[model samples]
Target: MSDQATLEVRNLQTHFFTKAGVVKAVDDVSFSVGKGKILGLVGESGSGKTVTGFSILGLVDEPGRVVGGEILYRGENLVGASQERMRQLRGNNIAMIFQDPMMTLNPVLRIDTQMIEAIKAHQKVSDDEARQRCRDALGQVGIPAPEERLKSYPHQFSGGMRQRVAIAIALLNKPELIVADEPTTALDVTIQGQILYEVQKLCAETGTAMIWITHDLSVVAGLADEVAVMYAGRVVESGEVDGVLDAPQHPYTAGLIGSVPSRNARGKRLQQIPGMTPSLLNLPVGCAFKTRCSYSTPVCEAAPVLSEVAGGRQVRCHHPLATEAV
Candidate 1:
C-alpha cells in the first residue's frame, strides 16, 4: 500500500428514519483506503458494511441519508456534493460492484452494448475505441474469448461469468476507487479465488483503491491490506490485516477471528461468539460487544472511543485483550 490515500471516511454516520425509530446504520465509522490497496470492511449481516458502501456512492434511497461526517475522495469532501456532481463522479472516478451481478448487468442488453455505453457515458470515446476497451476489460477479468462473450446477453453467461462481466463494467472507466459489496459470495471457490486474484492484479496495475465489503473473514485474510472490523454500526478494531488477525486486541475482533474454522485445532469444534449482534436502533448503552465479551466490566457501560494500541492497531474497548493472550 502506498502513502497516498484515495478515499477517506471520517466519523461517518448514516441513519434511517422510520416510524418505529431512527436507525443509525453506520455510526461514527471511519477508515481510509490507500491508492492500489484493498481495505476489507468486515462485518456480519446488518452490521452496516453494505450501507457504508452505499453512502459513499451516494446511492442510499429514501428514509436513509448520510447525516454526519466527511467522505473525502482524494482531498475533496463528497458528503454534500450536488446530484449532478455526484453523477459525474460515479462510474467515472468511483464505481461500485454489487453483491449480485444482476445489479450491475442489464438482462436485456448484450454485454458489449452495456459496457460500450458505460465507457461512452464517462468519456467521449468512439464506438470502436469503446468496444476495444470493453474487450480488454473482459480479458482483464479472466473472461475467455472476450470478443464472443461481448455478443452474448447476461443470461447467456453462468453465475461466475456474469460476475466477471459486472467487474469488467466497473473497470471500464478505470475508476480510481471501487466499492465491491460481496461480489464473489455466490461463486464457487475456484471461481472466487480466480476473481480475487484478477481484482488484486487489476488494483496493483491501475492504482485503484478498493473497499471490499464482506462478512467472510477468510476472504479478507487473503485479500486485504488492511481490515476494519465492525459490530453494531461501529468499527471495533482496525489495523494491518496480519496484525489484526494474528493479535486482535479487541474482544470482538478476537471472537470473530477465533470463530473462523481454520483457526481452530484439528478435529475440534469451531469457536463461536457468545451473543447476537445488537440492534442499531436499540443498542446497549455501553460497548456494543460488552454482552458478548468475557472481559466486560461496569466501565464498559460507557462507550470507548477508538484508541491506538500496540503494533499500530486501533481498538474500541475498555478491556482490550492483550496481544499475547489472544
Candidate 2:
C-alpha cells in the first residue's frame, strides 16, 4: 500500500433523519484506497455499504446526509463541498457506477449522445473524437457492434446490456477514482469475468483507485487488494484480502465465510449466522454484532473499537475468533 493514499475516509457518519427516529446508515466507517488499488466493501444488504459509496461521491440526498467525518480525496475534504464543485469533479476526477443502470443511463437519450456529452462535459474534446472514444469504451466492456449500439436508446437494451453500457460510461473519462456499487451482479458469469479482467487492467495501467461494493466474497477474493467487512453500519473488520478471507478474525466475517458454498461439505445445508441484523434506529447498547456473534462477552456490552490485531488486521470484537475456525 502507498503511504499517500488516493482516498481516505475517516470517521464517516451518514444518518437518515426520519420521522420515527434518526437512522445511522454509516457510522464511524473508515478506510483508504491507494492509487492503482481496489478496496472491496463487502456487507449484506442494508449494511450501509451502498450508502457509504454514495456518501463518498456527495450523492446522499436530503433527509440523509454525511453528519460527520472526512472524505479526503488526495487530502481534500469532500464533506459540504459546493454542488458546482462536485459537478466539476464528477465524471472526471471521480465517477460512480450505481447499482441501478438507470441511475447512470437516460431512458430518452441515445447511448452515443449521453457518452459524448459526458466526455465533452469535463474535457475539451471534439465531437468526433468523443464519439470514437464512446465506441471504444462500449467495445471494451464486451458490447458487440458498438457503432450500432451507440445509435440505440437505453430502453431498447436488455437489463444486462444496459448495465454493460453503464460500466462503459464510467470508464470513458478514466477518472482517478471510481465507486462501483455491485456493477457486475447483473451480468452472466462469462461477461462478469471479462468485466473483472478489464477493470483490473484499467486500474493497473491508469493508476486508478476504486471502491467495489458487493456482497459477493468470491468476487472480492479474486479482485480486491484489500477488504473491509461491514456490519450494522460499521466496518467490523478490515485487512489484506487473503489474510481476512483465509482466517477471518471477526465472528461476523467468519460466519460470512462459513456460509459460502465452497466452505461447506457437498449435499449439506449451508452454515448460517444466527439472527437478523439489528435495526439502526434501535441498535443494541454496545457492539452491533454481539447478538449474532458467538464470541460475544461481557466486554461486548461496551462497544469494541476497531483495533489492530495480529498480522496487521483490524477487528472490532471483544474476543476475536481463532484460526481453528477456518
Report how far residue 97 has shifted in candidate 1, in Å: 1.0
Per-residue lDDT over 1-326 for candidate 1, one digit per residue giving the tens place of the 0 to 100 score: 33658999999999999988999999999999989999999988999999999999999987999999999998889999999889988999999998987556888889889999888877898899999999999998889899999999999999999999989889989899999999999888999999999999989998899999999999999999999999989998999999998888988888888888773388998899987888888999988888888999999999999998866588999988877856
Worst 10 residues of 2 by lDDT: 98-107
RMSD of each: 1.7, 1.8
RMSD (CA, angstroms), candidate 1: 1.7
Top candidate (TM-score): 1
The Cα error of candidate 1 at residue 84, in Å, is: 1.0
lDDT of 2 by residue, 63-134 (tens): 998999999998889998998888888888889887766556888889999899889988899888999999
